[model samples]
Target: MSLTAFLHSRHGRGFSCRAEIEAHHAAAFRRFRARVMPRSPFYRGMADLPLKALPRMDKARLMANFSAINTCGIDHDAAMQVAIRAETSRDFRPLIGKVSVGLSTGTSGQRGLFLATPRERRLWAAIMLGCYWPELWRRQRVAFFMRADNALYRSLSNPLVRFAFFDLLSPFEDHLARLADLDPSVLIAPARILAMLAERQAAGGLALSPRRVISVAETLSPEDAALIERAFGTRVHQVYQATEGVLAMTCRLGHLHLNERWLRIDRDVIDAASGAFCPVIHDFTRESLPILNYRLDDVLIPDPDPCPCGCASQRIARIEGREDDVLWWPSVTGPRMVASEAIRTAIACLPQPLRDYRVVQQGRMLHLWLDAAAPGAEPALRTSLAGLARRLGAEPPALVFHRGLPPETDAKRRRIRVLPEARTGV
Candidate 1:
């Protein structure tokens, strides 16, 4: 990657208005489309076709037609083998030649393999630093805690930027010790892990003052965000990313703005009343694996007001979890899909705040998992959930409460999920 080009693209020009940002996105998309149409078999006949007219692609489709979808002639099975090896051995450095392979945690019901060239990795690093790090040139220490490590993530580590990765699968005590020693200026982790660290910070178990705390890989609840902010005396910023790419990051004004300069997004509005939509993304920065109009399952709420930061990029009000996480129940007429926000609101109305919790629906059974920290809070939780069911005008499923729920082996936490078998109709 050209350092000059990366710096110029990120910092040289500014979008004074939304029109200018849209124009930039249009140009980028055109360039990307022109480049990929002839090279990718999947897009071979889509030269002059409109984006909407093109068949929408999803995780399963992408994986099934991986070779045809990707411009690089990497075999899907070979890439999957490399990704699996990295996951089993916890070593993410082995590349398919120059291409880096990383595996998704399969939280969305299917595992995904992401490939990126060395240049693409550098560009990604630049974009991340440009968006999140205010003092880009200043020497700083960064602590990134996640389920898996990747060569792409390690590319950001340098003499000036001290980057350390803490594996979530490791013992909690081990992470605490390492965190205290590293004393990172920028701390990034899943919302749940950040909350745990905040509890330790409040109790004086950990002694570090990170300038910026970024939440990723999990939903950031308002309760958890407030606690983290109070503990660190800093706002808990967010990075909305997945195995596909870095989709958005919080601006200086704390609004999560889509990376429109590098990505073209087509919103598939699900709820017009609530300004909620699912994003169909086309990432122009990725070369090895071309992501064109790939629709994600996650739902996003758009901000009505403009961001104060003066960047005309589209701003997301909030991430409302995945469509799959929405619980389905039998209704008088048809299957009733319960929104995640309603469930979250019901849980938040409890008398006591839960340290961590998850709601899973399986075959007319609702399994509630609460951390041991919130003792005796289950009664209130149950009451609130029952109230939600009553308000929805549906029969409440059997509720099963499990105290002291253990964390998953991976860092990706699904606070709300619906089992595949139970997903069939009301």
Candidate 2:
């Protein structure tokens, strides 16, 4: 890690109030406007325009204009080729000059490309290490489980840090012995993977005593988090990151705080009552490929109360899967968003605990998969769901129970999902 980045990351730029955050954003934006914008051919002409005036960017559009959007003069086709080769071969060492290219297989199944320069990678390493490192003086083993490895992540490896990457594409059973031998001090993985490891530990098939456990790359439900914490005997810190940037991370108190020091976020509100909205990003730190006016479909429910940790940035209660994952139910006012939390809460209230469950909405009908001891659990679930619908002021969708949950996959585990077709049909 660079000395400057290490120093800055060790002690974050604390904000005393909302005004202080805005002032920091103003200075960052001023420097970005003067130095960063002119380099990108796409944003060069729009330097004087307000952030909102710039064209809105999503994965599709970002990939379409990748060549013009990046400040490093990296061609889209060339970068895609390099990234594809690395992904297919499982060798992530290839790079175009100093810029490393990687692919993101989003939940939508659409492939997206992300570029990071050497400086950006250094900053990322510094922030991740300086913030999450358990003990700086002691040599620590770090285990990272990810679908694909990138040069950005490799920066964590040094003589003082033994960074190991566990590939998700391979059979999970194969990793047991290697993981057991490594005895990582810091463990990081997707929430579901972490849950699986926790299950293994609980089953007496695995044993680990990691100082730090972090959940990344997936939306971690409260139930899963509780189980993981119980198994590991430590708080599970979460890093809400994307190809755009590290949007939010857990504070010392384990509260999710938006990374407002490097970027500004504009919310496109979906539900006014709950303060749920999609984040529109404006990252001043991403100079290589400026992520200005980039919008993400993931729904974030904001916490109105201040974080006890005293980070003045916004606190996100949870990252509710995607806009498409949010269930829509008919109401007197029209369709209302039935948040996943409500459904989880209703299930929690059931008299007989379900062994496992999955809720998938298929056009006005919900395929409720329940694994339980007795059939009476169905009626209890029905009653609980009906009560939830009433509380939300919405008519419940038809419930059709299945024997058990469908087979689990390494792909992101989302318990609640509303199909694309169900949105309009509902």
Candidate 3:
């Protein structure tokens, strides 16, 4: 497609009504289902079944059945070998036929490979640019920072769009220097890295005025967003992307809206009171590896009210960490699941400002690594956690405090984590 045509298709000038959005989603999903079911061994069995009746797929099942699950006919071992080599050498130019291979950060304890065809890569670029860049015709530069790179991300590099991938594994000073030299108009990175850059910008160590700043890969905490916006003097936007596909992005009004035009979300509610759910995504645009009724481990709080931006997509109030982060404590009846918010709220209510933190639950013990900006914060944190335990109708877990949290690996940071062995009522 020509640049002008692609822009027009994404902008969807005539797709303003809610009904129009629904119809478009339904049509796209039907077309995708029809095209992939016959080709994909994993999906072929459910070709004649309704989507709701089909068995739900998770990361473990998908990884185990990788070769059969994908319609691309690429062997699982071959894809993994290519993906791992790319990560090790930092050379992502290799591809399996026309399909690009990339690895998931394995934030949920298992690394998975994702495949995207050359055509699918271009489609992804269009959807991303349509969502984030209002002026598609204008020339702009984008700096994307992530642990790994692939052809799918590099496909956006063209005359109209100057795309540069910054390796997160490189030294911090090196990244800062390169970023200053590039002086990109659009900055995209994990929320943690963005927060660090905001600090650098505040200290006059970095010089750049990006028109658009997007948070990707990691959860964008409210604190991180506020800091980034304050430092850059621009609203901090976000892309709710995963290995699955581009699921959502922030609208012009700065609200996170689901990309329901190309993907459908089936909410698996984890907590009813706060409206937290694990989104089961059905992506219509991903043909290489068909993602149908794929359940994600992350938890999100859905917003029921319509967005003022007039976009018909569903809105999300916030992403409440991952389901693995939920604390499972023993209850009178059985092991009860405590929402991550409960622990986060306890820490946020502390007298001192928390610079960074990590909470891990092991059996009846809770380990906390807190970096507080003010003195007398540790005692306050302990007291708050005790209150949280009482509120949940459980005895307070034994607390252990560390001087500092360990540095995170390639995986996305999880402020709260519940050990796998921890039994839960669910």
List the global CA lDDT of all models: 0.80, 0.89, 0.81
Which segments of candidate 1 are over 4 A away from where they belong?
A: 1-18, 328-337, 351-358, 362-413
Q: Where does candidate 3 stray beyond 4 Å? A: 1-22, 329-337, 353-355, 370-376, 386-395, 401-411, 421-426
Highest-lDDT candidate = 2
Q: Per-residue lDDT for 1-426 in model 1, tens only?
A: 557545744574446787887788778768877876668887888868877787788888888988887777888999999999988888877988888888886565588889888888888787667656647678888999988898888887867789999998888788887788899999999998998999899998988899889998888878788889999999899988988887887777677888787788889987665767889998877778888789988888888887877777788887887766667666575555577768778777667766677888888898888775455587787787777777766777888988767467434565777777667755
lDDT of 3 at 357: 87
Winner of 1 and 3 under TM-score: 3
Q: What lDDT does model 1 reach?
A: 0.80
Per-residue lDDT of 368 in model 1: 85
Candidate ranking under lDDT, highest first, comes to 2, 3, 1
Tens-digit per-residue lDDT, 47-118, candidate 3: 777678877888888888899989999999999999999999999999999899998865765889899887
Predicted candidate 3, C-alpha RMSD: 3.1
Best by TM-score: 2
Question: In model 3, what are the clashing residue pairs, if there are any?
Answer: none
Instruction: Please give each candidate's TM-score.
Output: 0.85, 0.97, 0.88
In candidate 2, residue 334 scores what lDDT? 89
Q: Any runs in candidate 2 off by more than 4 Å, and if so which?
A: 1-5
**Model 1 weakest lDDT span, ten residues long:** 5-14
